[model samples]
Target: MVLIKDVGSEKDKKLSVSEYIKLLNNSLSNLYGEVIGEISEITISAKGHVYFVLKDKITGYVLPCTIWETNYLLNGIDMEIGMEILIKGRPEFYGPFGKLSFITKNVELVGDGALKKAYEKLKEKLEKEGLFDNSRKKTLPLFPKKIAVITSNYGAVIHDFTNNLRKSGFQIKILDCRVEGSESGPELALSVRALRGEDIDLLVIIRGGGSIQSLAGFNNEALVREIANFPTPVIIGVGHHEDVTLASLVADASESTPSLTAELIGRSWEKAEQSVDNIQRKIFSHYEYSLERSSKILRLTFEKAKKSFDKILKIHDNTKQSLRHGMQKIKEKIKETQNGVSDKKIYITQQFQKSIDEVNNKCLFNIPKFILKKYTKIIKDKQDSLKTLKKLIETNNPERQLELGY
Candidate 1:
């Protein structure tokens, strides 16, 4: 609370322009010490002085405000048009302009309602500027080895985040900062600056759930801007489901809880693991199918070869038996015709013996040789095909390809 001065005693005094301005300044040294209203207009000069009009909601009254550059920065409020604010200062009469203005010594945002109004205003402005577009958001890396976390180190949010992270190889760097109230603005700004030049893959900010008032810092314009232009992608887990902060809107990713944020960061590694498992299962299935098919083909070939050999053997036996029966019949004929023509009988026997010899050589040697040659060629072809299939499997093997830097 600010103290009020006695400006009533010198109100009726009449004097020259400069004299009157001086008198008014002395009398109102501490008067109009504090004012609460919505800003109707704001003007910033080249020299960094801020001029604005504060209007009362109920009375529709307006007061001009002058905040010097130094005071503006010290206040830590990102002032804008139509934002309801509380300003602490005294009244002043500018003699040259013949006007009255309030010299603001300190300025701060009002309550949650006022902050919400400002949030909506800033949100609209940023949305129109395309600051919240998905096209502008950066993609989080698949396996981030170095992570920079910004939050309250003493909070349960940090513990939950570390516990939920499944990857043991992550190198997490924590920068503890305020997560509530106006202090968050400067603290977060510094944290972002500190991490800007870091060798980090991602930036994370997390905090436990809190009231809208305590979480209002997440809605700060400074923090939002820092996140928008951050060097690395940002992940925000302030844990407010009902309301989304402007910082989250500008970040690369946003989650409702610290554990959820951790899961998101580790999603790439999880997907990779699943992919490897699927590939392994597929390779095993293919290998078993190849082996089964090869064995069946080999068995069928062996049976066909055996059947062919047996058929050739049967043909050889029948030919031999026919030759013997013919010889016996010739012998009977020669004996009966022994008294008729001995020469004719001898010639007939010789012709029959020559025919039998030709048949024996063809059936016993050439036929078996042809059968074995045909089956051997068939078996060789099948073996070559199986070797080709084996090579194809090895070529397509995932593990083998990985080793070769696929």
Candidate 2:
């Protein structure tokens, strides 16, 4: 539905050299195509325009070429004098110098050999600077909460990357840009710069597999250095098969496909989950073991306490029985002592009564006998005296007195 304008198609019109050249230049803009040649001479102007000689390998012919600064940067290829390359643009005649030259709109290394040479050259240079060293790589976060993705939005790379993430809560922000073609390197670099100060755990640049020329943006030195110096760890998923881009070498992590890039991030989450599960299982096992041990100790302590209590109870019973026996024996000994004391008291009383009765009888019989003997002697003396008196009285009275005096 859209119409295009052709500037130099009117060949029959009369025109001046300047006007014809301007017309020719306008026509050349419409005559866009590509040329393949080996670079023999090249120079970059102070303004960043590249002027080079493209030599025909077979014919030994050559063409002078000029690339505008912006277009030179878009391809991001560092061209060497001997390198073969494909330049896409049109032929133009300059009015001031009256010269014919190829004006390049885009540039690419022509074959795998050139690509390899470029890759090796850059690899060696960066390696010498330690950009590809493992010590320079940042360890990826275990669980990234915020992520920045740099890729073309029109492709399946974003879809695959987003679909493959396994974590529950992740803030994925996309900076859509060209991932192939002339401006891929500069645009990708711009995207990286835009994300530099962002609070992101990771910066991911993903692209599908491509030919060496198609994937040359990943090998761009500027983009590679941008990735190497990124504040966040960079994950480059920009190739397929065994191809390794310079960006991959310099990145913190690299994978072959978008799916693999996603898997790399998801694996961290999976591993973290597995670790937590293992720790949980360990804690549970230790708790069970401690509970079992504590139960065993409690049972043992109860048994020991029960045995000690039973022993004390038995000792108390023995002591109680011993005390009862001692009290009974003391009571019996007291009763026996009381009975012996009563018997001794009765015997002593009987002996004392017998002695007192005997003493009383002996005193009564002896006192009466002595009094009767004393009375009897005195009576005999009185009778003798009376008889003598009677005799004296008879003699004095007659002869009986003399006989009685003798």
Candidate 3:
């Protein structure tokens, strides 16, 4: 709606750039003076302002562009090299430079599809210089005792964050602020600056679900730069499934929603308990196998002793036949003596059984019961670990598992 007035430089009405700008402002009394298009060509000059072209129909025609230092100050765009943009401005003339141009008041970035070429050109320049390396990313703390949240206090984001973390026994301090649209950039930068407190563990930047335009505040250069340079790792929960901003890339971890971010923090604690339980299962399984093997070896030794007693009885029978018939009575007495020896063999067998019983009493019964106490303690420990894993899996609530997908 910006009116391009006919301020032709003729006769006594000479004008300076500042004076001309004032006249232009007066002539256009806030009729929403400019409507920036969705796509345009952007450029820069040595005089610290942006120059661009706004072409709608791809015809053999071009529109002049100009954005002064004040406009640039109010709306700070880092102006990536060869970036495509959409611009709106009021037409004006520079008397000294004798150049006619549009004084840009608003800008839009349309950097994909027909807009994609210039976007790729600028992205390549920054990427080749190593601006997007995974190694540059920071690690999130596992057990952050003190959490700092940056989000709107009156909304669902703060409610979701506080409820989840507080229920899980975390101490948090929230730095409440606006987080969307035209005015969000400066406020977010200010909120991040206030987190210079030393007691902070992890910082969470969050917002509830919002439109793409509403989410633009987070994509601003100042906000993104602040996130990249933050001391602690930042957790971004911008809450729009489709909008992944520059801030998302620079953050330590980005969550789709505030509730999901809180759950992630909760999962870390559960995983620690799961680790301890896994180790317990391994140790318990080893001891159980050892006890079973020892019992098998004891049973095999008892069977070997019974076989040796039978072989001794067969040798006794063979020796009696070797005796001559000359001394029949003497042979009879020797047979009786052998019978006595056989009776004594029965006594010896009884003694062997007594000794076996004693050994069994001391080893298999008394000592095994003592060792069983240790094994039983191990069993209890393993059981505790199993219970922990169950709790962890249940709390996470995997959707596939609920569908019985194993």
* Top-TM-score structure, candidate number: 2
lDDT-based ranking, best first?
Answer: 2, 1, 3
Name the lDDT value of residue 347 in candidate 1. Answer: 64
TM-score for candidate 1: 0.56
- Candidate 2 achieves a global lDDT of 0.81
Candidate 2 residue 27 C-alpha distance from true site, Å: 11
lDDT of 3 by residue, 64-157 (tens): 6777754554344555534455555566666567676777765545533422342344345545755456788788888777788898888667
TM-score for each of the candidates: 0.56, 0.62, 0.46
User: Which of candidates 1 and 3 is the stronger one according to TM-score?
Assistant: 1
Cα-based RMSD of the predictions, in order?
Answer: 26.4, 21.3, 34.8
- Regions more than 4 Å wrong, model 2: 1-43, 51-66, 79-105, 110-144, 154-156, 163-169, 181-183, 263-294, 333-406
Superior candidate under TM-score, 1 versus 2: 2
What digit string (tens of lDDT, one per residue) describes model 2 on residues 241-295? 4468888999999999899999898897888888999999999999999999999
| TM-score attained by model 2 | 0.62
Residue pairs in clash, model 2: 395-401
C-alpha root-mean-square deviation, candidate 3: 34.8
